[model samples]
Target: MENSISVVEGRTLHEISLQRKLWADLTAASLDFCEDLLQWSSCGNVAVTDTDLDRVVDRVLYMYVSEPLAYWLTGWFALACMNLLLQGKRDIEVFVFGAGPVAEAAILSLDHGAAHRILCVSVLSRHGISNQMLAAKLASKVHFKLDAVKDRTRLHRAGFVITATDAGAPLFEPHEISRNAVTLSLGIDDMPAEYFEMLFSQGGLAVGDDLVAMEARNVDPLSLYYSRRGLKLTEHGRADGVKNYSEILSDATLMERLKNWKGPASFLPVGLASLDVAVAAKIYEMLSITLSTKE
Candidate 1:
């Protein structure tokens, strides 16, 4: 009977295959959890292999099928907005009209070259820093000021406006802004349904940035990355041998996305104490993608 099968290294080939399949199932489950966390679904494919499992134990390290796609879409839209404003004979004055997390993230991400000048206008209700303080911190390059209520005559003449506020209602009244101004709303969901009715009624260009949907896409990369390292849980105390970040992020498209992205982004194995190991793996993944391009 097949029951006579002998075990090698304390396990049989069938056991190894079964383990791999179970690991795959675990990977799928983890991806479901992350999808729940991100509130979205995969926009790209996730590939799992033994190599990916060697490095992560009881953890998922996600990678993106096309990590740069979102950024590309965002950058292109931003450039298009800039071009629209420039063509309308408006000076490149980027007005930030709210104080929120996404707004703060954009402020943190902005480099001097992205926009000629940035003006952060806020109401007294919002507390972060006065526009003046922001200008001082930004080396006197970015202009910051209090949000005026009596009249927005200054904003009406501006070239660009970004409503980065979390306000549930419209920030600017339709027909209240410059006809040539390019407007973007980042923090709101279903922006068109919510605020664009008035903007459209007034003939203003309204763009929506759905970051939550973007987060949902490609969340499974973590699972594939972790599974490649041979580090998932089992009867053993803890399986060893995990791949570095480089092994994960080095995918061709991912590296391209990181070319100008100086922000903090990485993949870490669960149950890891030190970030050093995870960071090392991330770098390795980035390099791997870069090297593949040359080949």
Candidate 2:
């Protein structure tokens, strides 16, 4: 009766708990699948779509299966960026800029050890605590520290930051960012304009899923100028130029650039059709096996 009781909307209390577990497992799976895909010798090219996935319907799923997956893909890309930024580095201090599974997934994907302390900074009130507890519960080797946004000092020590704040203003000051920091930023507004100013003043690297398509679409700070409203058809800064993430991984040059890149760099990995398809396919495959064995 307890599991059957409807709490909110159409979901029962049972479904809500299942959703949390699914979020964590799916996060881990997405990261592993992407990493394996990168190393697959037969893999050739990746295609991406900006379209939302909504064909499947479930009372419990809500928008989780829809196009919002684009947002989670941004966090998955954080793995590639972190590896490049902190190569051969030990005792890495990872600071995640958002508290949800999407941001925590970045921490979950990282190399686990005694020395790694992941400082997960969140803006959510109670929801933030819920996510962190689930993450800390699931985290065996890695330590997940939940810190509020008001305690912004944690950002200063982050070597690899996975940010999914999707914020409209600076969560932390520009000076707080660690030198030569690399972040997987979900959008242009994830950090303050002043931060970008500082990055561009020195030298910063920027990458994406498909930069040319993004340039044509006029999304993200990669575009020279953009409007806050009025069709975003007019909406859109920093770094020498924006390169595609896949291409960077495919070649050693850009990874090398990221290795030696100075100042603070950010990555925008959302809106890629490739990522959505990959994640969807991976989740389906994994879930099917999990459901089949009743594990």
Candidate 3:
């Protein structure tokens, strides 16, 4: 007896064929091979020959780039925030503005390692109730609060704040920021020009992953707005001040300097390709070891 397949099954088969062809082309070109294989496997493309799949896996192990970009980016940001928090007192209050993927990653990063030090976490978003409820389940020990962005008064209580939204305008003014707060701006235009001016004026530091790249793209709202207002970003030696993640991570004296900061310090991390590559390589190494152990 023969069996009949539904329209959905037929369509799925066609998709699988197209996906296999695409993966073959990508693998042949040696373009993001590990990422492509991971993606292909995710689609449950079982028709791929075991020999070819094994070869691809071996190549990925040799190349050492296997993890997703989001994972590493989250780790780097979290590490930077943790380092900054360590410079100050313990018992920190963290506030995340925008409940997007990046914000969720930051929340997870903070919760996993620093729960003991983190007294409370407040997530301000349009979907505050749901995010707050989800966060409650994820980390019961860390107190969670759901608040709207309009609650300006709550901003002053946060010791560590991270902005992870694509809003074209500033979310909060500089005056609302608490003294000695460690703020990391992950979104393109989530911070205002006044905030940058205030950070520099108060002898606090403002750093980025790559200021040259950021200025070249002209997507950073703070830089564009400040440039339009006749506030020279580079001429005032602020460009010289922009430091990358490696610099921040390697500098032994940075923590001590940060400890003495009298006002808020801001970090603007424009995602870097190197970070993604490094993270992928690390994950690949770990997976390779696990597979070898199983064999």
- TM-score to true structure, per model: 0.37, 0.59, 0.67
Q: How many clashes does the backbone of model 2 have?
A: 7
Worst 10 residues of 2 by lDDT: 229-238
lDDT of 2 by residue, 1-295 (tens): 5655776543345544554453454456565655554343323233332223344565222112332244335545565566555554555566665665555445444533222533443333234565456455445634555444434556677766665555544455678878677766654555655666666666676666554455555545444322333222112221344445544555666667655555667776546454455566665554445455764
**By descending lDDT, how would the candidates be arranged?**
3, 2, 1
| Model 3 stretches with alpha carbons more than 4 Å out | 1-72, 140-150, 229-242, 245-254, 289-295
Judged by whole-model lDDT over C-alpha atoms, candidate 3 comes out at 0.57
- Candidate 2 deviation (Cα RMSD): 15.4
**Candidate 3 clashes between residue pairs 3 or more apart in a chain or in different chains:** none
Model 1 TM-score, all chains together: 0.37
Candidate 3's residue-wise lDDT over 187-288, tens digit each?
Answer: 777787777767666776666555545555556654665567675444443553645334454466885776655566777666656445544454455456
How many residue pairs in model 1 have overlapping backbones?
A: 40
Order the numbered candidates by TM-score, best leading. 3, 2, 1
| Better-scoring candidate (TM-score), 2 or 3 | 3
Tell me the lDDT of candidate 2: 0.51
Taking the tens digit of each residue's C-alpha lDDT, what string does model 1 give over 1-295?
3688766554465554544453343334333332322222322333322234335675544344333223222223333333322332322455565543344333433332244344434321145354444444444433343343233556665555655555644456646555545555443331233233343344332211211122233122222222334422121111222123222222455445433332212111221112223333443465456555776
